[model samples]
Every structure is written in C-alpha cells, then in structure tokens.
Target: MRDLFMQAVAYTSMWLAQREVFAYRDEALQNWTLPGGVEEVQATVLAKLRVALDYARSSNAYYAGVFASVGFDPLTMRGLEEISVLPIMTKDDIRRHRSDFEACESMNSHRVEGKTGGSTGQPLKFSMSRDDYLRSVGIGLAGWHFCGYVLGDRVGVLGGASIAKQDAVPWHISRSDLALNRRQFSAAVMDDNRIAQYWDYIARWEPAYLRGYPFALAELCRHRPKGCAGHYRPRAVLTTSEMLTESDRHIIEKALGAPVFDGWGLNDGGASAYECREHIGMHVDTTRAYVETVDDAGRPVWDMPGRIVVTSLTNKAFPFVRYDTGDMGVLAWRGCKCGRSGLMLTQILGRCDERLNIGGVRTEACAGSWLTDIDRVRRWRIVQDGPLHITITLDVDAGFDKRASEEAVTLSFVSRCSTVSIAFVYAPLPLPTDGSKWRSVVVLDSARHQTRVVAEKHA
Candidate 1:
C-alpha cells in the first residue's frame, strides 16, 4: 500500500513538473519499437537528423552564416555522407557565439538555464526551451526504464550541489524529494560523520535503487557502516557524471551486492549513452542525439578510436550540429547482442582525471556551478598540492574584482570542508598539451590520501 501511494505521488509530481514528459518518453521508446533490421533504424534516425539539420540551417543564426559561408545546404544534400561538409564546432566557437546558436523561432519559448565547466574547466552557460527541456528529461527517463527502473520506485540520489544543494537541513531532504519519493545525499561532503548519516538514512529508507557519481559511490562503499549491507540492499546501482573505473565498480558491487550500471552524457543536452543489462557497452541514445566518431580533421573514423562528435535532435532552441565533444570513443557498427539496435559505443575514454578529496570528501564537477554567473571570471582551474590546501587559479577579464570572487570561492569550498585552507592565484591558465583533454582538478598525491581513507575504514 505504501509503495502504491509513493508511486501515485511520483506520477503526480512528474505531471506537475512537465505535462509532456511521458509523451516524450513514449516518443523515445519508438527507437526500440522500430520494425526490421539495423539499416531500417538507421534510416529513421537519419530522417530525424535531416529535419534537425534543415532546422538549424534555416533557423539558427550561427548555422545560417556558416552554411552561407561554406555554400553547404542541408536541403540540397543528397546523403548522410554529405554532412561531413559542415565544419566541426569547437568549444571556443560556442563560448564566443553562444547567443547566435539559439534558434530565432524559439525566442518566445520559456528557457531552462544551465552551465557546465566541461572537460576543460572553462565555464559555458547554456539554455533550452521548455519543450526541449522536457524532451531531454523524457529521453533520460526512457534510459532509466531500460535499466529496469520504474517511475515512483524509491530512489536515493547521491549527487553534487547542482542536483541537490547542501542546504541547512540536517538530512538534506527537500519537499520535492518527498513528492517524488526520493532521498537526496550530498556528494560534496563525504566526511566520516556525513557518510555515517547517509548510511543511517539509507538503512531506514531502503531505497529500491541508488544513483550517484562513481567516486562518491566508491567512497560510500569504503566507509560503509558495519553490517549496513545486511539490513538493506538496492536492486541495482546507477552511476554517471564521472568515469566509472573498473576498480570503483568492483568496490561498489561488493559493498552493495548489486550490479553497477554506468552511463555517459553531456550536460549540454547534446548526447548520452547508457549501459544496458548486457553490461558490454553503452547504447547510444539516438532518440535525443546523433553521435559518431571522427578524426581531428572532421572525417569519420570507425577502424580506430577517434574524437566523439554529436548533433542534438531534441534541443532546437540551441542547435548543436557537428559539435566536437573533446572526448575519445570508438563506435561499433554492429548492433548489441541484447537485441537493441540503432547506435552503440564500444568504449568512452574521456574525463579521465584525478579527483580532489579533502579528508573523506571528494569533489567532482560541481565547481562549475559555483563559478557560474560571475562576469569577471573567464577560465578557472583547481589544484591541490597538500592534503587540506587548495589553490584556485582564475583567468579574469579586465575590471575583475579579486575580493568578491575570492570570498565566493572560499565560502564554496569551506562549506563542504570546514577545515580546508583556500588560496587564490591569478594568471592566464595553461592549456592542455597536444590536444589532450584538460585536467580540471589536479591533485599532486591523491593516491596517498585515497589509500589512507580506505585504510582508516578498516581501522
């Protein structure tokens, strides 16, 4: 009876949030239901791509100018291979011409604002129309459905400030959480006391499944309370936002007694791929984005690993066409053995950088959220040389206010780790060497402290 009641509340909350989410989810499921072989599915996806391309060519200002300059017309294009004529878009391009990327027709639609530091730790603010935002959510819900997660099943989400802010509340549970039958745990603060509190909440809540960053889940496993796994066990664990290393996967599985399902996606609403029950590789979500592998020169590559490029299908508000994701992956031409078709990524080799941990707390990508809307800041980097000391280097524009930004940075870190020391360094931050993805947070000797945390868990 309680389960039925929670499910009812979940459906009600989802309806209140977005009236069309379920419809979008149904639309996304069409990919799975498409009749016939792989070629048929590919044809359907390319049809959508054709629509997206033509929309950007006619609607988006940036694409309009680029299309004119290159003399490439999606309307005149004969085949999918012709898409290669479009130039690959870099992060710098979007950073400079963000406004021009928006479709002129979507100006009147309500916009949902978001920001990401991306792989380079350079902040970029983006938005999508209300309909596009709901579509993205629907597509994500479809992915969760593939993982055997039903809406309204109790879920405990462990995430950063972006997902669940570190509020003043003791349990960090919010009203919206109750409405959806979800519990929120802070990934920003994982000290011993907080970890203990999290476990207590989990034991009582007995969530049907748990979802969080790989590092945060690994930390929970390392310091999990005695016999905590005995009292309750989740059906499955979902991990995302960071690379899920094999070591972390093993640790989490051993601690929780459930299979760890990992996925990869961009915050920009561009592309996403999730691991099905097959556990072989992530299935490219063709319903939301079109993904492919390409060489540095924008030519498609299939025999070897190459840069991952994406074109968003749902987000017409800010069309991302031929957008270079600054990540490396290999696309398998074959379909999954699990009988699912369309697109599948054999591997994703991106965001492979060390994490910053002060004591038991490990910080991920939430730093991007902290620095959002700051006008003076251009690009930023976080470096940890000592255990409790962090230095933030910022590349500022003219008329930068050091005092205000410094206070903001200090308060952000100190709120998560009260004992940590914060310092500021101003300069033009260095670039990644030889086309490598930039290491956002650099920890000089992270392994030493990481080992200590595990050792203390045993003690």
Candidate 2:
C-alpha cells in the first residue's frame, strides 16, 4: 500500500513536471541542431568559447589574475585555433586555486555543491551552477534524439549511482528520474533472489530506453533466471562511466535487443562525449568543452592516442581549462558519417592508474580477456593495493568455480607481472553510494601519475 502511494505521488509529480522536461528537450534540440555542417560548428565553437572566456575573465578573479600574468585576452581569439595559446591545467591546479575559480555573481543563480568520485582515486569537491547543471541535461536529451527518445518517454536506469541515494522515493518512483520518464532499479543489491525481483520489476515496467553501467545491465540480461525473458525490448541501451569495449557493446546489443549508445564524461564537469546510432565513434560536446590530445612533449596531436586535455566551456562556477582527466584516447580528425561536424575521441584507454607500467605492456595485453568470461561471473573488480599485492573481487554465478577462477586471474597476472600475491574475494558486488565507480586498478605503492579521457551522456 505504501509502495502504491509513493508510485501515485511520483506519477502525479512527474505529470506536473513534464512541462520542464519538455522544455529541456526543446532546448536540447535547439542547442544541438547545427544546420551549417563543419563551418557552422566551427563558428559556434569559436563564438561560445570567446564569450565564455570573456565572462570568466571579467567575473572570475582567479582567471583575471592568471590571464593578466600571461597577458592573455579571450577577445583576441578569432578562431578555434587560438585556443592552443591557453595553458593546460590539472586537478591539483584547480584545487590550489579553488577559491579563485568561481565567478560568484553569475554563478550564484543555480549553485549547488558538487564533488567527483575521481575515477583515478583522487576526489575533488566543487560547485555546480544552474546552467552548469541544465546544459548537461540538455546534451543528454539531445543525444536521445538519435535513439528516438523525447521528454516524458519511459526511461529505466539500472545502476546504484548516487542518484539512487535520494531519500524522496524509490528510484523507480522518484520525480527526478521522471525527466527521461526514468524508472530506476538499484544495482547495489544483487543476488539470485534480488536479481529475480529486478527482472520482475523491469518486465512489468517495460521502459522505452534503458541506461546504466555496462556490467550491471549486462549481468541482469545474462542471468535473468532461466524463464524471465520478458517481452520488453527497449528502443535503445545507454552505457557509461567506465570504458565500453567493442566486445561488450556487441554482447549487450545482442542480449538486450536494443542498439547500444555509449557515452563518456568526467565527474569534475570537464568533458562529455556520446556514441550516436552509427556506433562508429563518439561525438564530443564541443559546445560544452574542448578536447585536445598532446604528445609526450605536450604538443597537440590530431590522430594518435596521447594525453587528453579537457577545457570546460560551460561551468563558470568551476572552470576547467585544459584539465587533465587522467584517461587516454586517440582523437580523430574527420567527421563521422552520421554527419555530425565536430572532433571525436576513439579507442578510450582506461586511467593512468589502470595502466600496467611494470611490463611496459599495452592495456589490452595486460588486462587480457578476463571480461570475456562474463558468463561465469556476475561482476568483477580488481584493485592493485601494493607493488605486488592485488585483490580480485567477483560476484560469481551458480556454475562458478573457485579453483578455476583463481587460476584464470593468477595466470592473467603472472604471465604479465612477477611476485604478485593475489587475494580473491567472492561475494556480492556492491555498487557505489556515489555515482559511477572508476579506478578498477589502483597502485597504492607508488606516487600517482596523470593521463586524460571522457563520459557516458548520462554521466
């Protein structure tokens, strides 16, 4: 009875809030529609950058002082090419001068305190203003156009993101999730019975669009308890937070009966990118931020995967100019066949912390294909605590073997690194109380190194 009452309250509130959600969809359409192709995109990018820079310099004391020191003027930038003249920054730089980063007057309109889980294991707190918050929603709504989704459409999110932590109501019945017409089920609580219950909920809900962490949703589809393949196929499936491999994409699309649209973004509000229907490459939100790749010498590169640098264009409350997000990827020069005329990032390499530095091995070689064995396990997380000490946690299924699993993990590492002591913890995997979880690999024994990367549109 209480559940029904909450559902009633949620439905009524969302009906009242549908107007705002519709407006957000309309605004996203207006913001995303670039009719002029490449030239138009370039013009819009230049104009927005110019305006954002001027506003930051004029209203932000920190930027004002920094610009004066370098004798830099935002007004002088005639083209996107001029962005190169600005200095690239990192999270530490933002923290050291955190107080100086805000443009208080303009930022106070919709300010809310924000913090990042820091995928690289370094968390940071910051502020999120009105436009800062809404513009992200706008981009996400816009991306759904590719999925044939509009505001007020049913959206079911399957994850234990902090958004699920709201006290107002159950995630599926919350007014907040109603924007995409979203109904959410917690990924944090998972086991045979709970998963079966989730399957029952989803079968009944029959959402139009599905969104969540890749592993969470994939496992649900993988282990739907034999006879629970409900006739509920969504129009699209959206994955985010961590990297999405081609193999993962194919498996998900095949199992869920929906095309997958992957996205990437930083928790610090630095960058955002999403995959379109084409599924070839992700289109970066050039309107919200600028993405650039640099070589070992810090010189910009167009094609190769190098250190990625992100500059946030919208967040005046916390401007991230050329901030290193500590994830690596290659940047492509040409336009996507989907006809979107903007720079795109491809081949996302996980964080610098996730990189195997000892064997001087590439990521694919070191991480191996353990994820390919998703059929045996429900989910997996690996944390490298020390130079040679590692912890492997798994939420395995009925047929899962402890001895075989240990052998697989140990072999994957021993073939790559020596003197590695492995600890296997087989228990139900817990979802983060915060947002999306990152940093599956941690090297606590060594000083932190930096790199760059992106987000899922829903991130």
Candidate 3:
C-alpha cells in the first residue's frame, strides 16, 4: 500500500511536470524540435549560451574572473564560433576556486553544496538547491525514457557510493529516493562471495533494465555463476562511467543476451548524451545543455575532434556555464536516423588527465586501443612515471603472450614517447573507487615513487 501510494504520487508529479515541459516543448517546437534539428537547435543553443554567460558573469564569481581575464563580454557574445574568445575552464581551475563556482545567492544562505568527480581522481565539492536536483533527475529520466524505459520498470544499478562499509553482511538495501526504482549493488566492495550474493539477489528480483559502470558489469559478466543465465534477462544493459570498450560491450551483451546502450553524464546529474535504438552515437540534449569541442589552446574546433565543454541550460541555482568537463570528443554535424534532432557526439576519447606521459610528450587514446584490445584481458591499468619509466598491469588469461604483447606495447610507447624507457609487469587487479568506477590511466611524478594499484575488475 505504501509503495503504491508513493508510486501514485510519483506518477502524478511526473504527469504535471511533463505537462509543463511539453507546453514548453510545443511552443519551442513551433520553432525547434526534439533530437535537435541542426539549424533550429543551433539558434536555441546560441540564445541559451548568451543567457547562461550573462547569468554566470553576474552571479558566479569564478566565471566572472574567467571572463574578465579573457576580456570577453558575456552579453555581447554572438555565435558558437566566437566561443573561442572565452577562456577554457579546466578541472584544476574549479578545484582551486571551489567556493567561487557557486552563485552568490547560494553562497550567502548556504542553500546547497557542490560536488565533483570525473575521469580525474581528484574529487570536488559544490552546491545546488533541491529544485536543481529534481530538474537534473527529470532530464536524466527523459533520456532513459527515450531509450524505452518507463517510470515503474524495475532497474538494476551497479555503482559505488560509500554508503556501506566493507565486509558488511547481507548488504543493506534502502528505499531511499536516491536509489529510485533500481536495486543498487555497490561494486566498491565486490568480491567473489559478494558478487555471488549479488547475483542471487538479482535472480530473485529480475529487474527489467541493468544500468551502471561498464567495468563493473563487464566483471560481473566475466565471473557470474554458471547456469545463472536462466534466472533473468534484462531488456537492455546500459553502461556509463568508464569508457565502454567494445570488448566490455561484447562481454555484457553476451552475458545478458541483450543489446547494450552506452551513455555519458556527469556528477552534476546531467545527461550529456544517450544512445538511441540506432546505437550510432550519443544524441546530445540540446534543449537543456549546450556542448562544444575545443582544442588545447581553448579555441573552438568544429568539424574536427577536440575537448568537450558543456553549459547547463537549467540550474539557475548553480550555473555550470561554459564548464570544461576535461573530456575529449567531437560534435559531429550528422544526425541520427532515429528522428531525434539533438547534436551527436561522434566519440569520447579518454580524459585529458588520463593521458600517459611518454617521456615529455603526452598521449591520449592509449588505453582504449591497446589495453582493451586483447579479448582475454578483463581489466588493466597503465601508470606513467616521468618520461622514462612506466608500468602496465593486467588481469587476463594465464596463456596470454606476455613477451610479444609487452614488446608490441613497448614499441607503441616508443613511437609515442621516442626517448622514454618502458616497463611492464602483471599484478593482481586493484579495486574500484567508492563509486564502482575504474581508472584506465594514472600519472605519477618521479618525485613520488609510491606504488599504487589503480585499476580493477568490477564484479
């Protein structure tokens, strides 16, 4: 009865909210449309960008300083092409001035707190209002619904949050709003025993959709109990967090006997992009977010690959205007045949910080192409210490050609970092962070020779 009442309330609230959004949609559709028709969406995004810039300049101290440094007037900014004039904000900038990121109103009353965590292990804290939280969730749900999920469908989420301590028995399950309709199993504490227990729980519940970090789901697929396939088959498996390698997708799809949809988002609780049934590339939510790709010089790069910058359209409580997410990808001009009009993200190359420093030269897309290329390798990590020294860890079949593989990897490294020395070693897999997410690459300064295991299998 209690669950039914809560469901009713959820349904009613969603209905009312959707009515308002649809009203906005109808009015907006008179000019623009969903999936973001290029010309119309571009116009909408430009207008929002101007508004967001104005809001940030006036309300966010961090952005105010940023704009002043670049000598760019937020009000007078014209089209996306001129975005190069604005200085690019990186993760380091946010970490150093965490307090300045908040809107003045929020800072004065302490109405919200800020939070941050991306490919970079450095976590940040920020603030937002209750309304901001709800809006974020609403936009996320809209994307899920676009991918065929409904409000009441049971979902399974495998993630990491420091909610429970390690070795806790019977893994406590809570009906918190944060968990929503999903049964969440923390990958942070994953072990053979815990994963077996999680599988038993999943068999009993038989959720409709499975969603979580790709690394965890891939680990689960690799180590699940034999004959467990008969118990349940989710309609689809959605992967997020870590880079969804083709091997990981293959493992997950084979285990669940279902299609795997890839998604990209941020801790700010905004859905940057989601794959439709077509599965070509993720469709950007142009109505509520504006995304741009910029080069290292912070200059906008259109019709080419570059770093991703996102500005949230909503979230007046804590504006994320022109926030550099540190991710590298391209905004392709092509649209999907699925009929959605939002901008399309061609690819998400790893994080800027995740790049391996081969000698003095930095490298990107190493993990995706090399470490994840071998089918038998379930998990791996690469740590670069200075230009000369590096280590490679692997979780793989014992029969793997370690000698040849190492030589090939060394050759690749030499090609990228011509004068650097290379080292390779196989170690026991490490564990995921508190969020059940994996790090593909970790950079270590030569001054700090501290050996830290960085990657793990996420069962």
For each candidate in turn, the TM-score is 0.75, 0.77, 0.82
Model 2 CA lDDT for position 108: 76
**Models ranked on lDDT:** 1, 3, 2
Winner by TM-score: 3
- For model 1, what is the C-alpha lDDT against the true structure? 0.72
Model 3 TM-score is 0.82
Please state the error at residue 279 of candidate 1 in Å: 0.3
lDDT of each: 0.72, 0.66, 0.67
Model 2 clashes, total count: 10
Count the clashes in each prediction: 0, 10, 13
Q: Model 3, range 1-459, lDDT digits (tens) per residue?
A: 544554565556556654354333333323224344677677777887788678778887887787888788866867777767766665577667767654354644624555655336667565555444554555566667656776656677786652232333234655442234556677777778877887887887777788877888888877788776466789898887667877788788877898998888774524367777888888776656678888888777866778788776655666666578877777875656876665788787778666664444556635435543466777778877654577777778777777767777777777876776766667668566455458777777551332221111211
lDDT, candidate 1, 1-459, per-residue tens: 788898888888899878699998887777755676567777777788888888887777788888888888776666566788788887799867766765453563677777764445565677776777787788778888767887788988876644455442226667877887778776656677878888887888788989887767776776788866566778899988766656567678877888998888785746877788899888777877888788768988874677788887767667788887766777865677777776778776654234566756755433444653344444566778676788788776678777766777778888878998878787975333221223446776665475466659868
Best by lDDT: 1
In candidate 3, residue 106 scores what lDDT? 61
Tens digit of per-residue lDDT, candidate 2, span 216-284 = 677677768766755778889888777775545656787778899988886465577778777777777
